[model samples]
Target: MKAELRGLPKDLAEVVAGHLVTAGMLIDDDPELAYRHAEAARRRAARLPVVREAAAETAYAAGHWDIALSEFRALRRMTGTDDFLPVMADCERALGRPQAAIKIAKEARHKQLEPALAIEMLIVEAGARADLGQQPEARRLLHQAILDLDDRRAAQLGLPAARLYYAYADVLEQTDRPADARQWFDRAARLDAEGDTDADERRDLLDGMSITFDDSDEDGSDEDGSDGSDSVEGESGEDESDEGESDEADEDEADEGESDESGSGQTRG
Candidate 1:
């Protein structure tokens, strides 16, 4: 990003860079403010692809779908790259243009994108299909993407794999396959080490009830409302200990009786 801004006057570049930095920092929590910062940067340096890209992403984060789409389109034209295709398609989806999103996805299929970008395209296309009530088509698309995943990549359990698993799991749940959905959600939760998706919470809700995933330290006890088998075993073990103590007490009493008889006989002697 600094390299991209180097073409501008130093003072103007500094200002624009500051806005971009603020935009990025707030994009996840205060997206409206982030969008404002991005827009300010774009107003100062609209010609820069990096500025436009920041504006496009912040607009998307702020739910300014039309602005996001326009900026992404401009970025694509300026850079002659299809790297932003997934986000542009998602903007179309946000604008209630599922057909346009699908079109963008189809066009993207012909381009050579990074693996993560390709997976994102599949996710957006599947979402568009679902928006059109083509649940089966959505499931097919996501399932195919899952199947096409690079084995090494999938094994890495990176964000891309987690996202793909999450999308597939969501489609399965929507299609009324709770068991299958739960399994995939479990996979997603495991892969999403960063908690980017709510896969853990989603799996716990497969039974139409929320089940909080236990993050407590393990004491061989179930805190997730499971059948309490461990608790029962603990109780049984306590019972056995009590019975053993009772038997020991009886033996001690008999030993005392034997001692008393022996002592009485010695006294008699």
Candidate 2:
């Protein structure tokens, strides 16, 4: 936090650092609280791009779509870059504004984006298409996006290719193409060792390892317990939980020796 805040004055840097510490600590376990801390940092250091980015990411994690979109817009204006367009567009989609999301995606400024960020925008745009009942278009866009990826670059970008496949598979299933869905889901699972998305669970459901059953069975429902064949929904609750990957494209970009650049007494990107 201190390194990222070095662009600010020393006094305000400490303040932002303290709030960022709180935000980072809570971001995974309690994202709402994390977002509060991030907003505090944003209030104190709204001029700094990193602070605004922190607030934007945490707000997105907490499902505060309106606030996230606002903060990302602020970040874009401050940085004069579209590095965050994918997340920003996704926030629009989350707010029940798919057309707005699509419009953001179609803007020409994003042509300058690095490959990973561009791929992320593709995923977000495909998701918006799905929201608008354009599954076929969504699947076609994602197919082109995957084909545009380089294998080595995909490996360096920390599993975006896997996520693209997952997004395509999800749209395929939604459009009632189960066999093709399974194929894409298989590709996603093979690439995603970290389980950053729910590809594994989706594959399992398609393969019928996951089952749904009535809970009111008198013969097997002993004291609300169950036999091995049919258990309650949460007995293995992985299906109910979201993977919360949100976006990872920036992580690939952020890994480019940021601390080393900050050590030279300036921020890069």
Candidate 3:
């Protein structure tokens, strides 16, 4: 508000400041109200680029995809910036215009964006692929995104890492690979310390849904043809291993060591 209201009359700046403050306060817990506040600010000072940006992001948070898209385009025009491309493409996806989303992504791919924004565009493109019944392509896109992050200075991709692993796990679950999905979900859970995702719940659900099988010889015999009680105990013990803990620990360290603190650019609700 300070910058955007720089040339405004004192009374007008005060009103806009109040609205923007209220919008920020409610954005996380009451997005509809926050959007209303943002709208008030936008209406009061429609010519300010920052005010328009606030309106676009608030509209997105409120699930008003069309309005968000329009405002984002306006922001692009005002600021001559391409950073908002991911959110714009995502709006296209939400509006069931996946082909349009794909076109936007293609055009933005070669443009220079921050790493976090780049990952967001990649995710939006992958989601658009899913919308087109191209789950394999979507999975492939996410998988390559993870590999790309690993190939780069991994220490700079914190937000993207969490989102990539979580998205990949979701695709794997949809493809009926629950075990692999569980592994990636665990990785995502460890990386997402802010609890931005439902990773822990997903992993817990997978654990509860898992089925245990006996690998003993037929006739209910162990290796030596003894009663299968020992085999059952062994299988139960196998389930009791610290594998999950160790895996989470290792992945957490890797995530912490490699990722920068930059946030993912998407507006979430």
Best by TM-score: 1
lDDT of each: 0.82, 0.76, 0.78
Higher lDDT: candidate 1 or 2? Answer: 1
In model 3, the clashing pairs are 155-258
Return model 2's CA RMSD, one decimal.
16.4
Give the CA lDDT, 0 to 100, for residue 116 in model 2.
68
Question: What's the true lDDT of residue 23 in model 1?
Answer: 96
- By TM-score, the candidates rank as 1, 3, 2
lDDT of 1 at 172: 89
Q: Which has the greatest lDDT?
A: 1
The 10-residue segment of model 1 with minimum total lDDT is 260-269
Q: Tens-digit lDDT track for model 3 on 140-255?
A: 99988887776345445655677878888988888878778878888888777888888876775555322345665455655663353342111123332233455356447434
Using lDDT, rank the candidates from best to worst.
Answer: 1, 3, 2
Candidate 3 TM-score, C-alpha based: 0.76
**Candidate 1: residue 112 Cα off by (Å):** 0.4
lDDT of 1 by residue, 132-180 (tens): 9999999999998888876677977488898999999999878877778
